[model samples]
Target: MSVRDLLVLGSASAVPTKARNHNGYLLRWDGHGLLFDPGEGTQRQMTYAGVSATDVTWICVTHFHGDHCLGVPGIVQRIARDGVEHPVDAVFPASGAAYWARLRHASAFRDTGVIRERPVSGERMPLDTGDAPFRLVARRLSHPVEAYGYRLEEPDGVTMLSGELAARGVRGPLVRRLQQDGRVTAPDGRTVTLEECGVTRPGQKVAFVMDTRLCDGVRELADGVDMLVIESTYLDEDAALAAEYGHLTAAQAARVAADAGVRHLVLTHFSERYRAEDEPRFAAEAAKAFDGEITLVHDLDRIAMPRRRTSGGGA
Candidate 1:
């Protein structure tokens, strides 16, 4: 069976508290595992999350910040140690090439050649994944440093309606042919098009917006996505601090989700200043704006992607 979920390995901001680690997130989509913003202790956190280095197909770094990319050394070494034969793509800002090189070879174990470097440079460039099921694009975010947010969008396809197929006497190989060719001849000598038997199913979209203030890039990434995992580093009261630090408050994150029609909003990368007891306050403030599903993540938390929207409903 296909699995799509977000595994929170670490959820702290710049500093790590006793309750929260640094920043790390693993997004399992189908057969691809996208590890995002892996900070310190990510290898250990992966062990706790029941994921291994081999499970990671892509390592997406938003910036060169220590809290975001510090774990690259350990993760790369682990992947080499574990003999991960598959090519692992590393996506980050092109300007941080030196930082990525340092971390990638920081005391390398065996130094496998399987790690493919895909440093993004432009404002809205799509990472080349060949024939992957989804298109991965990076957009520049408003941060103190060179930062980029990632968005995965599956192409829209058609879902064959069994009832419609049966009504048209389309069955067996004809159904497959109709899907592939967009039209097929039935046994009754009738030609049926794909639109006649299938409904347009909107593709699933997910965005990762981390270490960014309120910017157009954030909105573009969050637009019409099914799930949005964003950085909510501060509460509403600390809006000034959030702005100064190039981070988002819970209210700001929630308002973005509401405006972009995000079905599931995951608020993470919280500052260590907030206690565990203050977590609910984040949800409460976010609820005032976004009415959809909201999750305030912690270490080792697993959040499944929302179900696909029905036909005619926007993704």
Candidate 2:
């Protein structure tokens, strides 16, 4: 069966607590699985999550931070170990080419998986997964390191209405002909157009924002996305610390989600200072700014993709 879900493997920032692991996420979008920021011990996490190394079609590293990209070597090695025949695309910041090279070749065994390199920089950069119709977009974020956020966007298309088609007396091969030719002659000899039987369907969009403070890129990435998975590394009380570390507070992340009209806001990458008991506080702080569905992420949690927008592009 086809699947579209975001699986949280790890959700800690900088350091891993007894409960939280490092920072790893897997977004299974249709035919492709996109692994983002595979931090320390991600291979084990994937095993625990019932995910296979062969499932990964793309690996996206937000930055070269140890807490973000340490597991790349393990994951890459595992991919080679599995001997996946398909090519896997690896996306990273262009500035961290040396860091990426070092990590990719940190320790080589038998190189078998065909891992393709795709580096991103400044403003908006596009990455193609080759399997999906949608393209992934990378936007620079305000971080101490060269960090980038990613977005998956599907192109606009038309949604056929069966009722309209029936009413137009379009059936059998004629229906396919109408779709292919844009117009078809009905039994009544009247010309029926595809537009008359279909409505404009807006594509779905998902965004991932991590390890960044309040910045224009954050807003741009989160803008009108069905789901926004962002990092909330600190509580509102430690806003200064968040700023100094180039991270977002729960409230700040929520405000960005609210301003960007995000449908669902997933706050993760928590600090070790906040225990599991303090999770409510994080959700409450974000609730103050955003009225959308707020999810305080935890390890091994799976979030399904939001339902597609209705015809006429209603959210």
Candidate 3:
């Protein structure tokens, strides 16, 4: 019954539009929360999204762009104010160390927060020891600064089949015993192995990519992810400008998603140029190329992960 997938805090690119706040997103996995980008107005956005600093176990900054990470100061202060003692795993661009230091100490409040630096060193870095809920991997992107995108892949697990156990005369404590021992002696002294009654397979995967041009790294991060959250800062009409600024337009992003075999694509970091009602159009364009589910994110909206398929994979 664990909740996962995306909870958008603010989906706008820069300044808050009437309908949007700024660049902020929360990926709730298991009992842990990951705050990405965390642009301005993130404190209130968290409140609206029902996410507290205490729920945030990991913090990742793709780059130090104002639209991407301007709210770090307030977030840090709030974490201190909330008195969360659990160390937060933080990863930002190593090149932006000075900016991170400034944000970490921006407007000093009480000194009671722990932001453990886990900055990336190269094109790729593995975040976990492979035992975590999701295996995290970072890949460098073609941003102005030392920016990177993140991917979370859930390892495959075993699925217990009740009917299979029942047909084999496994009941009650014996079922529990079989699960724990991976095999058990039936009442008639028959041996039943877990492998015959259970399915152990690969789990789901989700990726997050923001503020990057259509580069190899973007495709690499988006590869086969159940869900991909990325920036669609421009519409197709502004493709020239998007290219000039190393950003992606809605159509281009959708094309990338389709090519990457993404199950669901959540587009965000929109440029303020679009009107409030233009979200549907943007999503439609994205869907044109990527027939998979396309969600044009709004601030404080929660998206549930797609149900796992019979093949033991996910959307």
User: What TM-score, computed on C-alpha atoms, does each candidate reach?
Assistant: 0.98, 0.96, 0.90
Q: Per-residue CA lDDT of candidate 2, range 14-108, in tens? A: 99988889999999977789999999999999999999998999999999899999999999999999888888999999999999999999984
TM-score of candidate 1 to 2 decimals? 0.98
Put the candidates in lDDT order, highest first: 1, 2, 3
Query: Looking at candidate 3, what is the lDDT of residue 46?
Result: 88
Q: What lDDT does model 2 reach?
A: 0.92
**What are the per-residue Cα lDDT tens digits for candidate 3 across 1-315?**
677868899988866788888888889999878899999999898887777999888889999989888988888888889999888888888888999999898885787648688878698988862344778888999977788999888877777888998889888898888878989998888899999889876577888999888899999999888888999999998999998888999999999999988888889888888887787889888878999888888788889887765444543
> Model-by-model lDDT, in order?
0.94, 0.92, 0.85
Query: Could you tell which candidate, 2 or 3, scores higher by lDDT?
Result: 2
Descending-TM-score candidate ranking: 1, 2, 3
| lDDT digits (tens) for residues 195-310 of candidate 1 | 99999898899999999889999999999999999999999999999999899999999999999999999999999899888999999999999999999998999999888988
Specify the poorest-scoring 10-residue window by lDDT in model 2. 126-135
Query: Any idea what lDDT model 1 has?
Result: 0.94
Cα error, residue 8 of model 3, in Å, equals 1.4
Off by over 4 Å in 1: none
